[model samples]
Target: MTTQENVRRVLDWAVAEIGVPGIVAEVKDGDQTWFASAGVADIRTGAARRPGEYLHTGSSGKAFTAAVLLSLEAEGRLSLEDTVNTRLPGVLGTNGYDGDKITIRHLLSNTGGLFPTGLAPEVSHRYATRSGILEHRFDTFTTEELLRIAVSQPPVGAPGDRFEYANGGFHLAGAIIEKITGNTYAEEVDRRVIQPLGLTHTRVRPLDDTGYPAPHPRAYSTLFLKDGADPSTVTPENWESLMEEPGQPPLDVTEFNTSLAWSAGNVVSTTGDMIHFVDSMVTGSLLPPAQHRQLWTTVSTEGSYWMPHARYGLGMFEFDKQATGGRTLRGVGGSLWGTWFLAVGTPDDQHTIAVHTNTEWKSWDLMFKLIEAEFGVAIGA
Candidate 1:
């Protein structure tokens, strides 16, 4: 069988065994590109997943935010060592923590130890449940509000000491970008990365965009609230109901506001655009020497999520070769309301695989299998 056929076989198996409604996967190996999709993008219309549909990639956008910051550093607008106090004084660490202790480097590396922010767990859990996202799909929030929710809590670890994924750090990074350039994160990303890269379909969701742009698939998930429970009656004690029901039909969650994540997880793009971004990023062609070093210098994440011994450098992740049979892959991966994505390639940008699914609820091993199929290296040995 052809290599493309074999890849399709793997995707089909994943759809059947993993039980996601639909998926779009693209692979770039040298000059050859293979694209495949299965199931339906919109169950209501039975629309097949397309190759060009956009998806809301969650934390994966962190890499893009980091790249934009590196670009700013290349321009001498800021330094990685600049502390939170330097950029936005009196705005961080209101919960008995010190903003002076955190640096831009620490935030990019996710070692800032800024509290995870109340919205982090709350949104994560809410999205995980079937209809939880529907509760406030149209609600809008400011970046300042999200940051306040985060700093309202104490630090998770000392600055630069340990790895703790804090979305607030990226939000603060966005704030710092605004402070330095006098532009919003969305505006900066457009000027630096999106427009220059010719990513026409890619965009940073504006604070008021409660719905996704057209030519996209509809996303679905289980309700976060209990069966027949009123959305208005939700309470912290029953918030655990946000867990997805294994055998229930998914509710449509395609339309929802993304400002809750702001610079941290609010970028939307297609599989092809993501692969292009990853290629430019890993090859060191995206930034200058000093800023490039900041992009690659990594610290251990100690097996966060599905990646074993993963190291985060800036906004990207470096999956260790030792854990993957001596073949290292670098990029980022995460899920959102109606999307789950993983993009990783060799450091030289010669080979790459990018996949997007319309559903976030699935077995973690499903992603690992997709990686192994595309890159010929199994994760976790």
Candidate 2:
């Protein structure tokens, strides 16, 4: 079968067997491009998933946050070496973290020992359960509120101690942007990157915007959290077992306020825009020489709570030749209620793949298969 056919098969398999509500993906290979989707956008109406629809880019926006800050550094407006103490004054010291020791770069790279909100039961309760999301879907959180939750917990470790996914660290980044430029992170991103690159479908989701633009698929989540449930234990494999009732339909969670996500997520985009935008990121087409080098400067994720096989850059990650498929694909990924997105490509921009399912989370087998199909990457190669 053709590679496109194989990719389509995987998408179909994801929907039919893996229980994703819908899926859309696009592959950009130099002058040629391919797009396809499977399953239903609106399960009730059987509407089709399409390529141009807006997608929730969860933590994928973290990359853009880093890019904008790096742009500032390029202009000598700020330095990545600046400490949290240096930038924000008194934010990190209270939570057993020493702001004096933590650099802005540590926040971007998630090595700052910041508290991971997902590890909090309260946070997991609200975002990972049907009942909780239904009740709190319209909730709005200020930047301060997010930061408060972040530091409420003790530090995960000392600064630069190891890799741990810290969502709130990027919110601190947004604060730094505001402190330096007198502009919100979103505004800086729009003024500097999105408009300049002509990324038509990319928009920074504001805190108050609870709905997606037109052509968005209804996102669903199979979150059936039982009482006293440890949210950390809930994975795709053990999902059904945790449900109140077996074989329940995934809950629709398309509309959600993104205020809490802010700099970490809060970006809505299309697959085309994602690959285009990420292409600029990995290729360093938009950064100066020094900042670009800093952008890709690597950190080991071996001790990370997420993506341990990957090596993290400022806001991106790379699976080097020693990683699973022995080919380097550097990019960012994000997961939220009802959506999981991955926009990655070869370091040289030879092939870019953006894929997502309008369902909570999965094994990402389909994403990897799509990449291999598009690039003709043999297993273990």
Candidate 3:
């Protein structure tokens, strides 16, 4: 029952009220599919946003990663119960951690206790601010470098103790995928998920900075910079002040290397592909019955500093949107340097909505508003 008019209002509000530069959304309800956008894709050119524009979907790619690994389990190539040490011997037994104690299940469910090293204050100070992102934006990072950075930090919690978001866990998953299949994580994802679903617009973990496709909106970063201060440490009051100051346009962060995120957060895809991908997942077309159940098996994310009030599943989440008529929706969501994305579908596979903004900041409510508009649900907005 999603109409174009409803979507248009939400998109307009996002531009007029939230100032995303541009936003794109796709909603599918049974045989009816609706696509719309508001604001200009390029602030300078004033170009209109298009449905076909490519989106770097960030950790939303985790669903694809989980699907690939779970598909391998369905094929008897692996088991969710397998320990990390059993797969990749010595990669994770560092910094007050025991690799033998962590299971593939724990990693997928966001309970592996791996620290998100990319979010470290020092790392952010060097590469997350407006100017900091420039120095090494084009640098291609190897998996070894990524792992070394991640495990250098102490474990946040014991494996299976709590729901703590960890991007490094997915890298561990990617390493296991390569070890078991003798194929790159990207290759396995291609053969198992992308090729099967005919998702032509999706590519995971780009190899270089040159891979960012054209005909896409220029990404803008709201990570404000001032003197030598890191943007990651910006408090709410100061961030508000920075936003209210005039003549401050967001930085164009479109050209950075996606390999900095590797298999964890770097899947560039489109809304069209995402809507279809989530639909396929809900219909159990991606994994066998046993494996699909494993994928949907829930672990409470109560104390999670990331995505609170949701239940973590295998690389995805089930959100009980009290603001959206208390309906429970299943999907994967993620944010990158300059994007906030949410791709959700009804549990029965009757409807799906995929939406994302060009900037990572100032997107909290705008995202749920997109869904509220399409599904005619109430927003606490």
Candidate whose TM-score is highest? 2
Candidate number with the higher lDDT (2 or 3): 2
Off by over 4 Å in 3: 1-3, 230-247, 321-326, 379-381
Better of 1 and 3 by lDDT: 3
TM-score of each prediction? 0.91, 0.93, 0.91
lDDT of 1 by residue, 55-125 (tens): 88888899878988889888888889999899999887477767888999998888987755533544544
Candidate 2 to truth, TM:
0.93
For model 2, what is the C-alpha lDDT against the true structure? 0.82
Give one digit per residue, the lDDT tens place, for model 2 in 59-92: 9999989989999898888888899889899887
lDDT of 3 by residue, 182-297 (tens): 98989989999999999998888557654467678888876555655555655423544433243467878887787766767688888989888988886677788999899888
Q: Is candidate 1 or candidate 2 better by lDDT?
A: 2
TM-score of 3: 0.91
**What is the RMSD, in Å, between candidate 2 and the native fold over all Cα?**
2.5
TM-score of 1: 0.91
What C-alpha lDDT do the candidate models reach, one value each? Answer: 0.78, 0.82, 0.78
lDDT of 3 at 343: 88
Order of all candidates by lDDT, from best down to worst?
2, 3, 1
Which regions in candidate 2 have their CA more than 4 angstroms from the true location? 228-246, 324-326, 378-381
